[model samples]
Target chain A: MHIRVENLTHIYNQGTPLERTALHEVNLEIEAGERIGLVGPTGSGKSTLVQHLAGLLQPTTGRVLLAGTPIHSKGATARSLRLQVGLAFQYPEDQIFEQSVFREVAFGPRNLGLDETEVKARVHWALEMVGLDPARIGPRMPFTLSGGERRRVALASILAMRPRVLILDEPTAGQDPQGRRALWEKVGQWQQETGMTLIIVSHALEELARLVERVIALRAGRVVADGPTREVLSDARLLRDIGLDVPEPVALLQALRQAGKDVRTDRLLPAEAAAEIASAWGLRRAGA
Target chain B: MKAIPIGMYVPGDSILHRLDPRVKMGVTLVLMTIPFAIHSPWSYLTLSAFIATLVLLAGVPPRTLWRTLRTVFGIAFLMFFLYLFTTPGEPLLAVGPIALTWQGVLAAGGQIYRLCLLVITASLLTFTTSPMQLTHGLEAMLSPLERVRLPVRELAMVLTIALRFVPTLQEEIDKLAKAQRARGADFTGGPLRRARNLVPIFVPIFVSAFRRADELATAMDARGFRSTPHRTRMRRLHLGYRDLLAMLIVLGLVLTLIGLG
Candidate 1:
């Protein structure tokens, strides 16, 4: 489903002394099959804004429409919206509680009142999608697993619901380099195969550059920038203003460009920069 | 739910804050016992005066006292009403279906006074002494019971962990509630329905709490927290001249109250 947010605003503890405005009048749209990256510093309201996409939070002032229907409209049930938008919370491992991994992953589907056979199939498929062998890992204690393994299992628990729009909040947080790369590849492939709308929130600019086609930058509960990945990320001044560090390669390319080198600062990822540099040198060699 | 800050000790350089927690604990124990011995109006007045003096010395604001008193106000009110009706003596006044007597007034006053003093003293200890120091004092006080394998250290450790995580779990609950509400879960239903609605929340909370407990256990194990008979203290409790003087003053007050009774 295409997620539509219109002038969304949310304030926590509305009348109390600790009241905080977590989201401003934000407007954005996620087209079907588009991979969107959400980048912001801590307390920038990226999480609050995305939580609205799944109808997990009601906008205090505006509205969120999923598939052109107002999710906060009267009679709209969270259970139905939850099925359409799967949210993998930060530190999702804390949400795992069942005796075994199988039961934990099966929780969402079961809550939806799916048939036993269907629940089992989704559980098996989700475990496999995250690259965990269901037979080997299904019965193991989730609490005893390694951190990376537990994170994948947590993601599997959400994936089992087969949400059309997958929202992962820092999916690669606390993972080693290898684990981070592997999980991104798996998620990217899954999005491509299923054409699911993917929204990933992360502080790691380099990691987000690898998976998303578009980037939405948030600062102080407002959207500072929302556009194509190359366009948003190439604006180093804006990124820095919002407290986000540019990806190393992007920063390096921008520096080289400032030094009058023929380098494309638009290339945000390391691989993209490397490929562009090699092609440029290849052209020079041909001319020579 | 923001952390309620119960049992939180704000570290300061004030005299009460600087006192050894063992000394505070001992004084608190003595004060708690004196209330039980109060049987007359004069003795209750003496106990109230002692509490008021301590409250002033501790420098706790009136707001803190009110917040602590609010928790036990219902019980205090109940005891007041019970004693007013039940105590027998020469009638002082009578209203429709209610008789007021000197004995009844004294009984009600005494009960209310005792309840107020108990709560105030407990609050003073908790407010002035950090949970870490309180737990240490408890471990020291219960050291003799260790011979009977009572697990004093383990119990203290558990208390410390619980105190540390109350704020964490409260923050988690707030986050989860916001998350669920964003998903359209209704929490504003009527009492019974609202109670039932807490299942989804309670499930996640209990899950997370257990997860935290497991992580804490692993961290503690990695730090070599084993059941050992010997451990050195970073700050040992010693009875300084000031503590001795404070203890003697408390003992004298207790004696005076008993003599008045």
Candidate 2:
């Protein structure tokens, strides 16, 4: 679905002593099949904004428009909006309840009221997309799987729903470097195959750089910058002012440029950074 | 549903909050037993006033107390109706074969009132005392049970941990429920289907809770937590004049109510 958030404001524990605004007049639009990254420090309302997109939370002021319809409406219409927007939470293993992996993944499709054959097909496809061998993992209990496997199962359960838009919150949190890389690779592959609209929320800017086409940086519940990932990431001072670390590769390039070496500072990917640094060193050697 | 309010200890510095939890426990025990000792309207009224006063002094939100009572109101009303219709006395109102009597109505009202008092007093204790203090007080009170070969300290630790996990588990369940909703698991259908849908949310919660329990055990072990019969506490319990005066007042009220009615 084409998602648009307009003047969205969310206040948690409204009217209570703990009342605080989690999001303040935040506005953004995600075109169908558009891939975007939501980057912010902790408590910057990243999770709150995504939850509103899924219609799990009502906006205190303004509305979230899914496919050109206000999803913040009451009752059945809003619920239908929720089904079309799939949200995979961080540590989604905590949401897994089915005894077997197949049954767990089939939950969303089954809830969508699909036929048994269709549900099974969706579950199988989802498992395969996540790089899990469904025939091997289907019968085993979800609790028996390793942590990484369980996380994949959790993702597959949401993927089986085949939502028009997919929002993943910190999918790589608490993982080792290899696990994180593997998760992003699988996610990227799945996105390519399905062409689903994707919004990924993470604090790690570099991880999101190569994953998303556009980046929206938030701080203190307000959108500080929203533009192409490369342009937004090029401004190291703006990122630092919002309490976000400049991604390592970007910082390295900027350091070289400051030392009077000619190099591009906008490359955030490791491979591109390595190539740029190598070429820059070779040029410096020739000049010397 | 929102988070369960089983152990919602609202922090405050009221006299009731500062009183020794052992004394608070003693008062609750004594008040709970009073209904069994005396069955008079005046006694119930005195108990209600005592509870209301403690509730007021504790600085607990009246809304919180009322929220707790609201859940039990239906059951209490049912009890009242049962007593009103079943008891035999001079008939006051007749509807076909069913007759309502003044004595029966009064008896029902007293029963429900006493029930309310019991609930209010218990909630008052939990609202004023933190789980840690309550656990420490329980250990100190049950220390005497150690002479009878009971594992008093271990039992107290278990109770404290269990109380602590109620909120943690509640939050976990809430998140899982939201996740299920996001996946189009409707919990608002027919009773049977709703019950069936609960499996998806609950199974994960059970497994996660167990996993959390295991982690907690490992973490505690790593921290060198041992269940020694005697251990130094972070806060020591001392019965000062305030605790003694509160206990004496509750005791005096119970005695006066017993003698009068």
lDDT of 2 by residue, A1-288 (tens): 788899999988675455788999999988999889998888999989999999888788989999888887777776787798999998887788877999989988987889999999999999998889999999999878998899999999999999889999999888788989999988888789889999999887777887899999888899999999998887899889888889888899999999998999988887778888888877443332
Model 1: per-residue Cα lDDT over A44-113, one tens digit each: 9988887788776667899988888887666636357656787878877766556789988887778667
Question: How do the residues B157-227 of candidate 1 rate in per-residue lDDT, one tens digit apiece?
Answer: 78888878877887888776654443334688699989876765788798777768899899988998886
Docking class of 2: medium
- In model 1 chain B, where is the ten-residue run with the lowest total lDDT? B1-10
| Candidate 2 lDDT, B182-236, residue by residue in tens | 9888888799988998987788787777888999999999999988736877778
Q: Please compute DockQ, using alpha carbons, for every candidate against the native two-chain complex.
A: 0.15, 0.55
lDDT score at residue B234, model 1, on the 0-100 scale: 88
TM-score of chain A of 2: 0.94
* Model 1 complex DockQ against the native: 0.15
Error of 1 at A61 (Å): 9.2
* TM-score, B chain alone, candidates in order: 0.89, 0.92
Q: Which residue runs does candidate 1 get wrong by more than 4 Å?
A: A1-34, A42-84, A100-102, A114-150, A162-165, A174-179, A189-197, A218-226, A237-245, A279-288, B10-14, B42-46, B49-67, B70-113, B139-260
What TM-score does chain A of model 1 get? Answer: 0.94
Residue pairs in clash, model 2: none
